[model samples]
Target: MADSFSQAARAATNELRQLFEPTPLQRNDHLSAQYGAEIWLKREDLTPVRSYKLRGAFTAMAAVLAQRSDQKVFVCASAGNHAQGVAFACRHFGVTGVIFMPVTTPEQKIAKTRIFGGDNIEIRLVGDYFDDTLAASQGYCAEAGGHFLAPFDDADVILGQASVGVEILDQLGKEPDIVILPVGGGGLSAGLTRLFRETGAASSFRYVEPFGGASLTAALAHGAPETLESVDSFVDGAAVARIGALPFETLKNVAMEHVILSKEDSLCATMIDMLNVEGIVLEPAGALAINALEQIKDQVKGKTVICVTSGGNFDFERLPEVKERAQRFLGRKKYFILRLPQRPGALRDFLGLLGPHDDIARFEYLKKSARNFGSVLIGIETTSPDAFEALFSRLDNAGFVYRDITNDDTVAQFII
Candidate 1:
């Protein structure tokens, strides 16, 4: 069965070539040197919709349409790359598509979906969360007698996503020693792992998921698909609450130890690194596999490894937040609450503690009621992590009372 599926996936990949060339499988020199390994990145970020979602969308639609000639209307629930993929495919096939996205989804993604689908797609902003939006889309599909397209989970969608694995092996002419996959709904990871196994490839697999939305980990722990209570939407593309049932069927036997979790903030650092060093813009989900490389550096040393950069639909508006998060993760930035003596020269005295390279990014007095001292919120950024040590040493030597709030998510959420 797996062999048959692999053959079908290969055919799907061939058909997909007419839609867009295989995404580049380029060697990343910077990462290779850093990890002491041959690090290659499968550039799914360079896909026509800036993601590999289109592969699954197109392949699933085509597979379904191949069997039934009368189905033309398709509906899907996605606020990110999947919507764009379905929209683009809808336009390509000249079919009507209805996309349901969360009300809180960024306007940029909505606009891109519109651009990809053109007149072939109609997007409707529905619920505040994906679950609600999904329910609404399914309800509409049932009511209108339209075909419902799942983002993942379905066998056809999984087969479509298998094209990524097919492309990787074809482009590299051989499988790498290790394949790191970013898991959301499990479509891509399941597809890749199944294809590789069926083809007798001996590559080790590492699954990475956002720490805040580790549905795959949770499912592994429970031995079944499980819904998370809450998910941080920062890594919107891979932030799935529950692993898809069908995808899980293929991924069920993956050892739990091979799955890695990446902090959302730390993931931003990898995004910054790729953008600054390689000029590669990656969405939070796209950076997951690369960000997780640090966790298994020993295993991959002196070996050939591949990281699938899933998507790059990054909005420049989030650049500032990404940089700030990256700096915090690297210890190049700090935020603190300072209790300053309410005196004429207090501000100047506090300023003297900063090193030459340190610069204040934020400073706001939180409380003015204390006649003896004032509570101050200050954020400092520096070029090197050493600057923070010097700045803190100076503050300690000067006997300044302060509380570092940089790592306090509760307080930083509002102030930082």
Candidate 2:
């Protein structure tokens, strides 16, 4: 079975080569030095659609076209990379594709998908959420007699994704000591695990998921794929509410200890570090494995580690948000609701309480016409983590009433 899966992976990869060259597997000297490990990055973000989604898209679409010569239409639902992948594949195969995207999807993504598909695909902005868009697409697929290409659930898609593992082994010319993969629907993790298992490669696996959407962790705990009550969509590429049933079959054996849940805000710091230090623009999902390195620093020391950098379809518009999140996670920034007395020197007193390196980023008075006091929302950025301690101490010493909403997600959600 391993041999056959290996062959299938190779064949699928070979077929894909006709469309575009394989994504590079580059060694990172900086990460290697930092972790005391030989770190390699499987640069799947460099794909034609800027994601690994294309491999699955092509493999699934090709199988459908081969099996049913009469089927000329394909349908899929995605807010980003997956949609672009299907679009590119549809154009490559000269087939018509209808892509359904959530109305809330960024315009940059929708435009890129359109550009990739050109005349071969039509896009529909239907629902506000992915589930709604998926339902609409499936309904259309059924009504129009078009083939539906699942983003990660299908067997063919998993097989296609396995090719990444094959490429890694071939490129590195040796088995990596550790393979760190970011999990979304479990397709990539499932495919890679199967490939390694079949090939008998001795690389241990570490799965990383954004803490808000730890579908893989939930599944492993429940012994089956379970739907999450809510998923933070910040890590859009790997933020699935549920793991795919087909993918979970292979991933069922994954040890909970091997799974790493990355905090959404901390992941932003990793992104910033990569961008500033490595000049890599990683979307939140793409930063997962790298961010997990923070939690497992001791385990990977002096080992050969491979981090699969997934998707790079990030909007520059979100850079400020990412920066803010990163700063807060690093303790270099804080937000608070200060109750300021309605007096002339109150603002000056609060300003005087700030340390030398502290900078005011946001100052919004919630109530202008209060009788005696006003609720002031404030955001402060400091030079170092310890700077927050000094500033907070000063605030307390000065007897100014303030509520730190820095770690308060509920309060931060509304004001920050």
Native-vs-model 2 lDDT? 0.92
For each candidate in turn, give its C-alpha RMSD to the true structure in angstroms.
1.3, 1.4
Kindly give the stretch of ten consecutive residues in candidate 1 with the minimal lDDT sum.
1-10
Query: Least accurate stretch of 10 residues (summed lDDT) in model 2?
Result: 1-10
The lDDT per prediction is: 0.93, 0.92
* Candidate 1 lDDT by residue in tens digits, 80-127: 999999999999999999999999998999999999999999999999
Q: In angstroms, how far off is 266's CA in candidate 2?
A: 1.0
The TM-score measured for candidate 2 stands at 0.97
**Clashes, model 1:** 0
Clashing residue pairs in candidate 1 (N, C-alpha, C atoms within 3 angstroms): none
